[model samples]
Target chain A: MNNTLATIDTPAALIERSRMQRNIARMQQRMNELGVRFRPHVKTSKCIAVAKAQRDGGAQGITVSTLKEAEQFFAEGFTDILYAVGMAPHRLQHAMDLRRRGCALGILTDGVESARAIVEFGRANGEVFDVLIEVDTDGHRSGIRPEEDALLEVAHVLHDGGMRLGGVMTHAGSSYELDTPEALRAMAEQERSGCVRAAQRLRDAGLSCPVVSVGSTPTALMAEALEGVTEVRAGVYVFFDLVMRNIGVCTEDDIALSVLTTVIGHQADKGWAIVDSGWMAMSRDRGTQKQKRDFGYGQVCSVDGTVLDGYVLSGANQEHGILSREGAPDTGIAARFPIGTRLRILPNHACATGAQFPEYQALSEDGSLETWGRFHGW
Target chain B: MNNTLATIDTPAALIERSRMQRNIARMQQRMNELGVRFRPHVKTSKCIAVAKAQRDGGAQGITVSTLKEAEQFFAEGFTDILYAVGMAPHRLQHAMDLRRRGCALGILTDGVESARAIVEFGRANGEVFDVLIEVDTDGHRSGIRPEEDALLEVAHVLHDGGMRLGGVMTHAGSSYELDTPEALRAMAEQERSGCVRAAQRLRDAGLSCPVVSVGSTPTALMAEALEGVTEVRAGVYVFFDLVMRNIGVCTEDDIALSVLTTVIGHQADKGWAIVDSGWMAMSRDRGTQKQKRDFGYGQVCSVDGTVLDGYVLSGANQEHGILSREGAPDTGIAARFPIGTRLRILPNHACATGAQFPEYQALSEDGSLETWGRFHGW
Candidate 1:
């Protein structure tokens, strides 16, 4: 910001605050129009400022991938939080501790095995935990299918075992692979229908399942209707990335997170200008590798946030990234990006890339920068 | 280590202390037998505890990839450090400051442009920087060719400009692609010959090139003799992962680092048991993707550290890993690795994986554990 890139250290995670705020406003407005409470996943930034901005933009609550996030956000005065990952039994005590501390934390379970553990832990601790049953709408990762008998069984375990069956949620994570609006809309419908179906099953079993939640960045932005869904959640939309660009969800301009790097050296003959933001800074997440158009580590941008059409980080090591043109080699790469010239690299996955940094240098529209701390690890 | 895995949180970075010490001993012993000083790269562990073990075992100094590492390690009393990446002109002031603060810091450069900058900065500051000429041994990443005229040009620029021509260094990073002992040994020789030749060029040009350094984890262990080499540098050997195992550098039993995770849920019909160690825990290195043996994200090991044949992390999301057998679906995955079962995941690239965590749970042979803090970011 304010051309201070020359002064800040190389390989710094930079948040283009203006773009980020715009992205937040867009999502919040969309969710508002859709008539559903928007719970933004804070796992993308893990920064209180970012989540605070979301909340400021009308995010009803926050979603987290780990209990660590729940604790950190809770400590930051965000009481309504969801530890979205399927609950591991060993983490029951930790989750219960947060609940006991009055964090209003919501724990998720996909099976009777973990639901039983949650019930047992609650019974032993004399606490009734608010539980969300994870339903799988897509064959991607975790959760029980909406039609599976385990859905009712897990719901009954939580309800009959004296725990508060709060809701059912599903993430169409496989929506990341889609490039068409039609497919995204269908997937959104499926996610909404499947999660709503699970909620119905619980209610039919005489259990109170109040919340029906479903979303992913693509589906959330493309869904024609929410129908029975009470809330929607999405993470990476906060700082769109190249992978999202490839999926036709967001443009490169929507990307807010970028790694500010300095040209360290060059391999002139190979048409390479080595930058200081390697995998350690940009992260090893090659989320764009198999996409329709692969942005080799990231898409290169001018220091002022304008996209550099051809240049990309074509290769990377522990601490060096080879920035080069995509088609033929830029033979005058050294002249093009001389040593000490600062540039920005838009990451493939904002969540993975942001996790690589301890703090972000948030660049505001007024050309001022703010240091925002982000928590790491569980 | 004692089976205290269950007590520790899932998705934790675990260092097998005994195995790490043994790895330190093995590398130190090889360096001693070769009559070369060993400077273990601190980039892999960044944990002063791990580097301390290497120092006590016979490593003379340490190799670091960034100035942040130099600062952190210097603060920890590791005054002798080599900043191995190509020196960026902007970082010269920081490097000089460290030198002024009594850090025997060594910086590197590959071409005339950066070499000129280093010389000018040193002269203007009246601080003679200890500069290493980075020689390209295998045409991998950075560094000038060992036989190129620019090698001597860089040396003369430092020497004539009133700076210390510290020496020459080369990392045989290409050895990571070799699996056989013969190929590894050959790579070691190539690395040695190229770096020694560069140092010879400097000495022949009447410049003081006191040190000749060479290595990588594979090359450092496989080199038959050091000859004119003064020191060897290697990282990741301290915590060998699947990439090293596939490179035939270290055995499964010798790997000292792993991710401690627990089964959180399962997609029984799909034979997928989801664990807490996802890309966020294990990293997205995929270093072994092109190697002879591709360990998806990581290799599966029992909580006690025994390698589980045919079991691998088939897919991973941000917070979930799909664990399944290789050739066939383990239909009874739920019964085999039920909910709450703790497991250890050996990562693909230890350097990349270890950086994912802020600290490591060091497990001692006596069943005791110590928390070793690791610094992250630049």
Candidate 2:
């Protein structure tokens, strides 16, 4: 593999380096202009190579979805790590180890049970960690009400237990449900306000909450104002996928990661082209299911890395994908490529699909291969 | 870690040794009575430890989804292996190497392109590989039509290129869609007839076709007659999941694997309990989406390893899942589960969830932990 030059590689993930750098820089510039810290989530690309790019591009810290990821990134010299998932007692020992290793660790918690568990674990282990109260801006997933008194009660318990109250964090997971930029912007405000209001409740209770984090790629990219948000944590923007395109977040040209597959067969009667990249390689993440048009799994691209018009992967099995054009122009894709011809498929969700493979064959601007490691499992 | 006894370690993936043994023996006896060879697909449980169980239960051969799995099982003294995935030119050399090590290797192909590629690779490497012509039974994924002349053409091409034609194989991927035993039996007939007809077409073309394989857990377990079928290659039956239950293939008690997760939080107002098991652990495979009752991701069970009547995971984020009542009696799950209480989740799709984790903390009949070994990955 060449350090600077490149060639296409098959049966591997091809990530565009320049596109990733641009995405990171774009997010950083926006956050910096708004006077907010950028703490991009590390779950999208569980690779140290991409995390370093974020750090180099001006990330003050990083958000992780798993404690395993926090440990891996910390070992690789990433000090300021946030375990974004709701922390449990079974994983407290691992969190304490990260703190002992001279790293600032922040954990997300919502209910009194978790808050009490954290307090009890901290008291028993003599470990003082940062706690972030996860506020549910939209009823998309887990979190407590930001404006409720429960926020202060949870904060008081953590503060009394010697654990520093970091602040409040909320993901506008509902932003992924938006159909327009205005909707995304509105959700972004809700996310910002939710975290800020939760932090304000902590302040009203005489607690010094420092950081207010808000995130979700769709909202983070479209938000016009950060307001009271101290930091932004978005992950999927580094590798925009088909889901982003369907939601109008990006275009086909903006997608940076794809699965390289080979044409295995053709059904002339049905005008179906079979490819080796199936749901296993592309992932069954139907993030685009809510969109107006559902591209079964992903958008089919040509061997030269160009998105083919009217051709979509209609369905996928475990090891095979069916490429078809429903009542569209018949270009005879079967004749264009004989068997063994390789093509790249832009994924529906980059994080989900990329997680399927162990490593990525990073492609330079000119299309050369450079292997980059991807961490897996919790 | 104890070699002599099963330990009560994690609550997730508690395997009942006796139940598994019975399931294996039943399938083996049924296939034997049908006069069809049992080549259990090993992708369901990539653990060599589980493969040993299959071998001990009289599995003559094993099917693998990846070359890495083939290599691993071959090293474990499993000589006969069928690489069930479509043969790509890039991976042909690896398959040839496995054959050179005195392993009986069979490759699957459905397209003329793959047929030609496999022939070219085999000719170049001077190796003879047994080939299975995959027939598309219900259009679930990949394969040629059983009645299409393309099947004969591909078989003729393989024979002309000096590759031995092993027989025909077809999977009724739609069998997973059936909700009745009658539907399953019908799918089994369709699967059997499809492969048998394809083999007949090859024989009519003056080609020697010895094997005719038909499979799918539902079809294999419910089919009354094997007729012209030479072998069965069903996977999922060993570790039934929520999807199987929804499809009426197996009951919740038949499921062997479950993700043990600790309750992290709860939304008392919404009546939701949050667990540490997310898509990262349980997988994003919503296999039950087409069923009448869509198990959001999995069925929730008590810590004692019993399925709760009405509890089902309603939604999942990257690292958190929400469990709520489906239709059964309310068990006050939200109030009962504290932050540290452990729960078990039966996966929607065993193959997908099993692939996410590195190893299983195998359990015994009495809910005690057994030995652990890492799974092979590409």
Candidate 3:
């Protein structure tokens, strides 16, 4: 028996398969036109089906935030995987194990101390680890600046010891804060230049720096050109969320992931229809709170996925979301959304919301639902 | 080799087993003294070991926020469970299935429409669900007011229509906002009296209101007396967090759950030691934002578990937590906590943080760690 939206359980993560495919194609097409290899970050969906679709749409290799993702995707037959987060020493053994198992697993690092640890671990284990020097183009998180002398120093530590100095990678995650095309385009250019510059510096120092990777959904989409960059990587764009929408990267209709929820009860006088999608379901990611338009929890959609204007999740508890109108209290909230009403809530952050679920209910255009399993935790 | 604090992976949820046991004992003792049965809300930990410990410490039953949790706990020999979320009509079939499976699953309802649906579903399925009317004691979330005419109306709807009107239950969730003992005691008394009044109203109207239940971690700990309350229920108290800390119910030392993370890299000039535990590990719940003292993402503690004054997760990305000093950037952060430095972060909400991980590393007093698994989603 095939399950439609009606038959599937509430508080389940739903990926509108058509929208997801379209989102994948849009990014792939842009990457194709830009003349760069597209490595879709598997960290967003973490489901093989979604990663497979991205690959089908012309993704080169998968980029992952955790080694667990590399292991999972590798088991699913993905050979080339990049462990994008700065590699911690303790995880080196796990990374080495994955590489030994035929996973072309590449890890990242930014400092001299970390580089020494990586070299030391590789030397002790009698293995050469493929390492990417994480560059800080935006100064938002971890990474040495592209022009910093430390970049050459870290590269030397990995190269001087027996290790593959893979290349340079930077994520201009600060692009999330920008809304205008100019700011996004600027961020993209900055990201591309910084990463490419690091690669140039490594080469100037007579070292092997082949790969040059850079991205974030905004930078990936708005970049005018990918001049010296070999590849671009992105994750959240596969399921464009409210955060992306606010950043002007994607529209609400472009959002592929939403939590299918049920209107369980209501507080009529308060004009709140309590739904089953709380922080536990929709997630506590209030990514929209600081955005141009704050969708408290999320924007409420009808059962058929049509936008229900003004109705938003005003407040949320563990398993209960209070869905109310944006302005003037939704006086008829009870009658408007009676008990048993199934509603879809577009999440604030797809990655965060997706993590809350053990499996994704991929609803195709024909209303047939397929359970796509995704793993969580390290 | 057994994994300990030094060896276990970073960004892992660590439950201080002794602290958890103490938390359980404290709540159970309070309920025992108040002359009421204690039903620990398992939604916080969701680990069978934690639930078993609660039961072992004198809990009468378990309260669940999801049917999935009820099913999981039931499979683990926890038969007496209360599905505390409002009764959504779409879930009636699932509820009936659980009841028929010999699990004494108690469901909740707050309105006549839902009550009627329950009775209808009950008659059609010929299964009498042990139903409780949720009362809004503190005007926080779900439930009918004690004095509302709908209280008797819904109770009669269940009784007259042939469903078991087991009792009335209310959660003084607003107690989370009050920090002073006077305010908490007032809220606790209010939570107790209102729930008792609602149960009294149902009994006065010739309905069998066998139970009068009420609780919230703050209220449960501060309540001078339970009065007519038959049972007290609370979840976060099992692993009290900063929210409970600020609410004056528990001190920082009482917090049992902490995210064990490692310094992956550093932004020395910015005074940031980027850790592997980001929003992905801690959860994007900025629950402490509106509190008097906002610990950005969480309060940073040493690996050996001592609070580092003026240190908090100033910022967090997907898998990168920017650990920094509160007032000023510690320029010597790189040397102060060099790369690979292990640290533990006490989260704002234990329930939200715990949900981020698939399993917890329960660290004993002797510093040995054991994995305790927990489930997510509907």
Candidate 4:
């Protein structure tokens, strides 16, 4: 079948090939100019096709959220990998298996308990694993307090064991809370300073701390300089979504992935056009909830992929989405949809929506499509 | 390998052979006593194992959300299936293919556009399709207005095109809005009235309406009688979730599935205990958003699988979930979680969350774990 036919024929994730290549190149150039290594997180586009583009665009290594992702990317021939999630005993065997399969795995840990578990697992299994001490930069999520002595204690615990300590890593998660590039830049400084101080503390205590990793799409993209950081791990940059747009990191045009849906029915009296795509297809991730503009779930686009004026997915049921053009004239476009008109919906969080499907139908700038597989589960 | 070890080791979905058997018997007995046929929706578990149980429970047919699901269930010896989503021109070919594969495929369409598309597709493919006229009850989602003459007009288009008019079906999606059993029964009446009225109109027009399907877990369970309804297509009753609990459909103890996550870290002073499971594993479906009590995502349970006192997932990052017990004493319980303590989290929406992961580790009431695989993608 022709690629265009393939794109429209099946229920698949359509990724514009040209847009993705451009997104990868742009991030790579920006990181290169900043003298930092690009460790593009593979969690966004779990497809191997997209990961190779990142590699070709000068990504030295990649970051993964799960061991399954690490193994999948490793099998596709990208080796230098950092399993960015905190290691657990249940996953230790899987981590060791990945390491044994020739993957240079770098696991993250924040507490003494996790450090002790990793030490015990590594010693018992005779697996010498590399570790990154996670530091809490903005106190938004997981990580050890950067100023606390616990950082040194965890480092000592890992060092005394056979594992290698790969410096400190932190995510400026709260940077997403910023509305301006200046705010993002400030959070970036906080992220870098937090990790740098943690690494320095460990080194001053006579511990080897080499790799200082810090990230978040906003912080990484707007940061003035890395300073002491060696690598940046940003995942969402690969496939920017509406949340990224709301944070001022990228515009709507920069979002490369979207959920392709069909306009199925309407309630013209209610000024509502119902689409076949619902939370099941588009995901219920309301990332824009905290943003200046909460596009309910996402922005609605025309069949030919134009952003519809004043159209938004006003509300969504399990398998149905209600579209409304609140401030615009109801030009009977709802009836015009005619049951089979294809529509593309920009997602709130690419990672969440993208994970719902098993693959992406790689679409060219010319609208031709091909299938590229995605990863799911653990 | 023993089924117990297989469940514990594989991250795929598992069905507690016994729990499923009991769930099937209970539903079947309830439906049989109510004098209604059970055409259980296959979209919930989407597993052959579960479908077989439905068949063994004497389900004459099944409802499916997508053609892909129809194909999977059909291949596994299910012949009677309803393609529950509104039919589009694009999917008509797949629907025809399923008919050719010897499955009795029923297509749902509520508009002239879909009616015309199905007619043309069926005419071109020389395949006769059984079609259900979808009726909009309570204006929750897709279906022609029951009070409008459009339902008859759409039915005429399908009948003129050589398609068999099976009957009418409507989902009481607004039944989810009801808080009490009386409210659910009221919505159930609305669902039944809409479909029965539409079917009567078709019959009055000299058209044979052989079936009437009404469904929604709340509506079906609380429904005093089917009355004019011939079959029901409820799925979530098999694996109740937090949303079901909020809707008063099932108690928390009836929830059979949960994500077994490990506590990985914590911010000691902030009272945030990080777990490995996040939206990636738990899904971004906040189905209980409208409920009186909003569990941010899901309810947190102890390692032994009991609901914890006041513990809930307050906030979540991509790979880490923050567990909090508002105003509860530090209890030193968080410390016990330490890095590798396993905890099970009940999902908000079983269908959406279950779809995120490729499989489920079925844990039995007796504490045995088994792996059960689930279908994914279109």
TM-score of chain A of each: 0.98, 0.96, 0.99, 0.96
Clashing pairs in 3: none
User: Using DockQ as the measure, what is the rank order of every candidate, best first?
Assistant: 1, 3, 4, 2
Fnat of model 1, as a fraction: 0.88
Query: Which regions of candidate 4 fall more than 4 Å away from where they truly are?
Result: A5-7, A328-331, B1-19, B329-331, B365-367
Better of 2 and 4 by TM-score: 4
lDDT of 1 by residue, B1-378 (tens): 433666887788999999999998888888888899889999999988998999999889899999988999999899999999999998999999999999999999888889999989888889989999899899888899988988888888888888888899999888988999999999999999999988888888778878999989999999998899998899989989888999898888898999999999998888899999899998989998999998899889989999999899989888899999998799999999999998999999999989999999999877677899998998
**After superposition, candidate 1 runs with Cα above 4 Å error:** A1-3, B1-3
True contacts kept of each: 0.88, 0.54, 0.86, 0.78
What local distance difference test score does each model get? 0.91, 0.82, 0.92, 0.81
Q: What does candidate 1's lDDT look like per residue over A145-185, in tens digits?
A: 98889998888888889999999999999999899989989
TM-score of 4: 0.96
* Model 4 C-alpha lDDT per residue in residues A241-347, reported as the tens digit of each score: 88999999888878888878877777766777778777877788988987898887788876556787577887886567887776764768666565667777888
| Interface DockQ of each model | 0.86, 0.54, 0.85, 0.66
Classify candidate 1 by CAPRI docking class.
high
Clashing pairs in 4: A13-A361, B7-B370, B7-B371, B12-B359, B12-B360, B13-B359, B13-B360, B13-B372, B14-B360, B14-B372
Ten-residue segment with the worst summed lDDT in candidate 3 chain A? Answer: A1-10
Docking verdict class for candidate 4: medium
Please write out the lDDT profile of model 3 over residues A8-70, one tens digit for every residue.
888889999999999999999999999999999988898999999999999999998888888
Residue A74, model 1: Cα distance from true site in angstroms? 0.8
